[model samples]
Target: MKITIAYIEEPPFGWTGRDQAAMGADIELADVVLRAIGVSTIHHHLTSFDELLPGIQEGRWDMNVPLFVTPERAQRVAFSVPVWSIGDGFLLHCGNPKVLTSYEAVAARSDARLGIIAGQVQFESAKSAGVLDRQIVLFKDQPDAISALRAGMIDAYASTAVGNRVLAESADNAALEAVAHNNGGDGRVPIGAFSFNKSNHDLIKAVNKRLIEYLGSADHRARMERYGLTHTEIDGAIISQSAKY
Candidate 1:
């Protein structure tokens, strides 16, 4: 059957907007993998990260692509074996400006403005950390937040580790730098797989099996590196943690 893939339309992932043309690492990886298994005719596009959960919960879409299998989310949806592990951390403007490092550091500063993704787990993390509701500026999506960051509207941004590399490297802002989590950043955030309904167990298992094959291949590592995944252990954690399955 044709898979209607739902993903957040953003760079180094997949998005169809001005400036950015088509698929990124995740988009291409998903398409290639699914088609290899004879699931051709992929209709892929972007959806807000929050909207994916709502849409899938309501059956508005068949899958949420490039997903990370969080225990909380896994309890409600069927997730394929992870296809990628995305590490995330802080992205700050070029230069050692402010010498910013950790979220707590940003929080301690009264002048700091944090750019966060609304309805995302990171937002919850910030909230749990007591990020003042006012100090936290919520954006509709990642790219929107990045734009604000480049404009110097925000002090620093909490972002996926890979996102930091891409924005710093490819994005217009060449000065952006990704400070690894150990330097007071969150070690990494994992991103992979799609969330299918529990009824799609067959699909889920098939995807997992394919993941085993894919991950073992050198090509997969190349793909991950392209997307900014440096932590190999994340791949193991993604599958092992799914024991809750």
Candidate 2:
């Protein structure tokens, strides 16, 4: 069997490597689960965030790299078991001149501006935290948002805390910093999972079963660690799934 999976350039999760191969935590996880399920070949389709759901829904791909699960998104695609749980954070200029540590903090200041990728859950999260549309700027991808930040077009860029940390560490100038979301003391983090077309029940079931058996294993933990994920994120997925049952 062969499968095609869609992925976006979101580091620590998915990205196009120097050799033009899809590489990252989610990509590797998908490969393992698919191969274990008897898939003989896998195709990695590179796409933008806005296209991930629509592409899968249209059968343009068999599945997508793990993306944050939301009820609105679940309505469009079948999601596998949760793979990772992560919280939001800000990628700001080093020294954080605006002192923007949280969505609420960005909203509280009239002059504060926040950057988010178009069609991402972060936009909704920012809106829920009282950030006005006027204070928010949308970009097509991470590089554009990071460029806007470096150019002083936006005060902060919102994404997963782990991803932002990776970006900050890899940046050439060391000019960026990542600040984990405050969560307002609620400690609620979002969980992500591979998504398939609603009609692909057989494939979804197989992948979910394999994922349940694989996640949090010593080998899985070691592989994920290479992408900057620790047991905190990996085990959180298991814990979150347990709570649901």
Candidate 3:
């Protein structure tokens, strides 16, 4: 059998590498799980982030992996039990003068402008933390958002912790840093999951069963670490699934 998976660019989760191959922890994991379930051929389709859900709904793709699940999204697509939970963070100048590490901090400032990729959980989280829509400056992708932050066009760039870390570590960005979101409480930690067309109930179940097995393995741990995820984070994510959701 064969399957087509759609995704947008988000490092450590999913992206088109320099060689134009779909590569990331989530992409590789999906490949492994699909092959294990007798999917001999897998196709990766790159779509605009804004199009992922609508594309899935229209059957433009068989599925979408690397979506950060929320109640709103779950209502639209069938989500497999989350592979892990991760939170948003900020990529800021070296000094982080405004200390915009968490959404709450940005929300607290009337003058603060935060750059976020359009249609991402970071945008949702910012709103949840009381950020007004006017204060948000949506960019088309991470590079654009990062550029805005670097050029002082935005106070900070909001995105995933792993993504920010990867960006800040780049040679050209030596003056920036990645700061994890810790707002004195659980402030909008999103569970990451693959989304399937709502009608693919059997396929969702099959993938979820295989995913759970894969998540429990040492191979998963190594794959995650390669993308800068800490063991504690994934472990807590698994436990939180049962405890909170």
- The most accurate candidate by TM-score is 2
For model 3 the local lDDT of residue 92 reads: 89
* TM-score-based ranking: 2, 3, 1
Q: In model 1, which residue pairs have backbone atoms overlapping below 3 Å? A: 67-192, 87-161, 88-160, 88-161, 181-185
lDDT of 2 by residue, 1-245 (tens): 99999999889899999999999999999999999999999999999999999999999989999999999999999998899999899999999988899999999999999999999999999999899999999999988998899999999999999999888898463998999987667777899999999999999999988998999999999999999999889988999888873
For each candidate, give its TM-score against the true structure: 0.84, 0.98, 0.92
Q: Put down candidate 3 lDDT per residue, 122-223, tens digits, no spaces.
A: 887789999999999999877688778888999888887777888788798998999987745644366788898999887888897887777757988888
Tens digits of per-residue lDDT for model 1, 1-245: 78777888555666675754456766776776777677967777467887887777777776777666677887777777666555546778878487667666666777788888876666666666666778889898888888888898987778666667677787477778877455235444455666877776666676667666666467766765666554463465455546534
Q: State, as a TM-score between 0 and 1, how close model 2 is to the true structure.
A: 0.98
TM-score of 1: 0.84
Whole-model lDDT, model 1: 0.69
Model 3: ten consecutive residues of lowest lDDT: 182-191
Error of 1 at 60 (Å): 2.3
Better of 1 and 2 by lDDT: 2
Model 3 TM-score (2 dp): 0.92
> After superposition, which runs of candidate 3 have C-alpha atoms over 4 Å from their true positions?
183-188, 241-245
**lDDT score, candidate 1, position 93:** 86
